[model samples]
Target chain A: MFYREAGEFKTSYVDDNQTFPIRFDRYRYYFVLFAAFLVIPFAVNDYWVNAVFMPFLIYSIAAIGLNILVGYCGQVSLGTGGFMAVGAYACYKLMTAMPEVNIFFHVLMAGGITAMVGMAFGLPSLRIKGFYLAVATLAAQFFLVWLFNKVPWFYNYSASGQISAPERTVFGIAVTGANTSAWASYMFCLVFVFICGILARNLTRGTQGRKWMAIRDMDIAAEIIGVDPLKSKLSAFAVSSFFIGVSGALFFSVYLGAVEVGEAFGITKSFLVLFMVIIGGLGSIFGSFAGAAFLVLLPVLLKNVLVGMLGWPTDLAAHLEFMIVGAMIIIFLIAEPHGLAQLWRVAKEKLRLWPFPH
Target chain B: MSNEEGYVTADGRKIGGTLMEMKNITLRFGGVKAITDISFDIKEGEIRAIIGPNGAGKSSMLNVISGFYVPQEGEVWFKGAKRPQMRPYQVAQQGIARTFQNIALFEGMSVLDNVMTGRLNYMKSNILHQAMWKGKAEKEEVENREAVEKIIDFLEIQSIRKTPVARLPYGLKKRVELARALAAEPMLLLLDEPMAGMNVEEKEDMSRFILDVNDEFGTTIALIEHDMGVVMDLSDRVVVMDYGKKIGDGTPDEVRSNQDVIDAYLGVSHD
Candidate 1:
């Protein structure tokens, strides 16, 4: 009864085209934002911040990026890890080379650099698609990792071959490095996530989104109907990589603080982000967030319930986690390929028609 | 046809000089010739039909006009200019829009979004503006939506505007495709078998829409159709092709009376 939109009349096109057309949805979105920004920082401790909130916020950004490329644009990419490395390294280089600049600009700059690199790798997509495009992006992933590993300049000639974030601040509040308070860092990543989410949602609802969807649905028909494939595909790459890059920057500088190219941002990391997009839902922005949250919480939930409570071996829990996630992917692909986002949509749809089964 | 003044039809609709001319066009696919030295002109504000049996290259000629296939030998003149070799999108941006024989709607999108895609070239706001969803991008989007809504209303598909194209019936899908093309506000509209698999009522509806579009918007239409009666009733002029060659080009009566056109349609006994 509360979810119904029976009397909500949209007299104008702009009203009808809103991100949340329903009055209830708009309020719900606002409530969620208020909780994320105003309530959560005051409540959570370091363990909760680092373990659950940090990874969820950061991976949400990465999932949004990959979804734009694969879900919206229909260009399969297996190089999210490599592209994220570009962002992390670029942020590292920016942080070290310009010590006085704020950490916020550093993250934005890193994303810009990653976007350029992402566009370069995205060129092959015009000539190839599907599994072939995935393979091409995989090459990008390996090549980026190797470049970061082999190049001494990237790690600043450190003997350990690891890059660490130097302490940085915005408005005299420490947002990075060892001395940062839990709330401070969480707020920093939270702000980025909020901005990125709004930007992504806005972009997807407009003309740019339509062109990308057109290209995805049918390239030949899209071209014939006046969408330039090159522009649409490359822009998807640029925007997606930009988000992935920002997430990577935050991941390295704020979240991890110290990362080895091989260990932290590797092939597995790429697959993890792709899994979030797939299991969340394709072609839906809310799906990206849902997928990220689901995957991030799954491991933690499995570890606590299976190992901590049941007294199972840690390694067994890890293996079981793998099997469960694998089985989930298969089931989702077979039953609800659109993922949790679609499931959520169906639930909302049903709720709207409740009290009667029409 | 050469008169500079341009004459009005018996129905009081004005028809102008040729809008597009295909001169000696030849298209080949490595030992296979699809269209061979065929020539035709589509005049302004008239419904033109290209009719042929299966594999007679009617679709190939349409492809050539839409810039999908570059003819090896021909000059395409549009509005008195020798058209350059343009990508299909560039051709579309030059005010040419078309529907496919097989419904080529973006099945994943809603009817409104599919129709909105036709206005992509017209929606000129940059990525930044769109990302912000404020100022220019939002304004341009509203403006385009207004235009698209007009087309949707004109085609009487208001109820299914939010429905995904994949879920629509074949008849509605065809109508949606026409709505999309019309949303482009194209100077020249190309339709490939618009009434291909429609029932009698559907065909009648489609024919009325086509005639209404031509009369109201004054859109110049070029269509390839198989149903002879529908083609004769709808088109002002008909071009008959047989095995990669133009057999007849004239008014419906002129084409229907041609011996070669009759032989192509009724079959000839060669002894």
Candidate 2:
């Protein structure tokens, strides 16, 4: 009853086709954005920024990227970690080489570089599909990790073979490397995420998004109906990798401040993002954020309860975290293959028809 | 009424010059031949039907026309120009649109979205414009939506516009597929087994819609069907194939009286 569009009418196609057509939804969205921008920066601390907000925000971008490819485009990829590494490494190279430029440009350029790499790996997808494509992307994951580790040039030939973000500022306030405040880093990543989210949301809701879904639902039919598989698939890879790369740039430069390729972006990292997509929902933007938040926050919540409160061993809590994530994945796959997005959809549907049993 | 170039049908609609012509088209999957030395021309604004028993390669011929299969030998001509070796989307860009033998609607997408995809060829806004979704992109989308809405209304699928194709019944799904193909506003519309697996009422509805679409849009149609009754009622001309060979090609009544077509349908003795 409270969530009704009874009196609200859309007078124009533009009004009807908005991202959030309902007044209530639109307001809620604005409120969330307001809170994230105005309120969170003030309230955020180093502990909350590093442990909770940073990971959630960063992974949300990655999940959005992976969701566009696997969820909307129907191309399964397990090379998210590798693409992120490409982003991280690209950002690192850009920062060190072009120290005079803005860090924002470096992040965007890093995303662009990763997008090209993603499209290169995505070529095999035109000839292969399903499990075969998955395997091909797995090869990309291995090759990329190997490239960063063996090539020492990627790390600027550092003696330690690790890439570190140098001190960089946006508007003269440090947003990367040491001496950066928690809010500075948080706001920096937040800006990227917000822009990425809008771009992704708009792309998915428009003509391009329809083409991807058309391909995902039925490739042959999509072709007959005038969707170019090459353009669609490659564009999906380009856009998805762009987001993933930006997140990777932020993950390395803003959040962690230092990174060893193997330790930072391994197979586990790939699986972690994959799990976020699976558990959150495959073909939903909201599910990306939901999955990222759920997975990112779960470990911290578990750690606090099990280790900090109950005095349980750290390793035990870590093991339990793994088991819980695994069990959640299985449950979501079995119970609701569409993930939490479907659940949210059903809830809204019910709310729409409230107070009357059909 | 008889015209200089082509004759008028019983309903007084003048059929125009050749829109698409297939000359000596031969298709094969490795050693297995699908269509052998088949030649046909679909006149503008006429309903051309291909009918044969199982394994007659009618579907393969449709595939060739739609550019899904590249004939090992032969030329496909559209609008008096020899079509190049191109992809399906290229063929679609050339105003050739088709529906599958099986319902090929995007099962996960709403009927509106599925139909909207038909306008992908007409969408000219670049990726950057689409990402921002303002100005040209928004205007183009609204324009496409208007076109799709008209088709939905034309097909009487307005009630199910927002419904996913997977949730629809067989008949409705078939209609949605037709709506999608029509949304392309194709010059040459190909329908493979449009009435397959439908009840008599559903078949009648499909036939009526097909005729209405042809009459209203003046769309040149080429279809494959197993039902002779629907074929005879709906198509102006019919092409009969048997074992990858064209057995007969004529008007419905001419094909009905052809000895070879009767022999092929009745399983006549080879000796």
Question: In every candidate, what fraction of the native interface contacts is reproduced?
Answer: 0.86, 0.92
Question: Model 2: per-residue lDDT, tens digit, A131-180?
Answer: 99999999999999999999989999999999999999999999997999
- Candidate 1 lDDT over A1-358, as tens digits, reads 7587999999998899898999999999999999988999999999999999999999999999999999999999999999999999999999999999889999999999999999999999999999999999999999999999999999999999999998999899998899999999999999999999999988888999999999999998999899998999999999999999999999999999999998988999999999999989999899999999988888888889999899999998899988997887788778988799999989998888887868
Q: Report the Cα lDDT for residue A167, model 1.
A: 93
Q: Considering summed lDDT, which 10 consecutive residues are worst modelled in model 2 chain B?
A: B1-10
lDDT of 1 at B52: 91
Model 2 residue B87 CA deviation (Å) reads 1.2
Model 2 error, position A326 (Å): 2.3
Instruction: Quote the positional error of residue A22 for candidate 1 in Å.
Output: 0.7
Find the number of clashing residue pairs for candidate 2.
0
Off by over 4 Å in 2: B1-4, B269-271
In candidate 2, how many Å is residue B158 off?
0.7
Q: Across residues B1-271, which tens digit of lDDT does each residue of candidate 2 receive?
A: 2233777887788899888888999999999999999998889999999999999999999988888899999999999899999999888998989998888889888888888998998899999998988899999999999998899999999898878788999999999999989999999999999999999999998999999999999999999998888899889988999999999998899999999999999978969
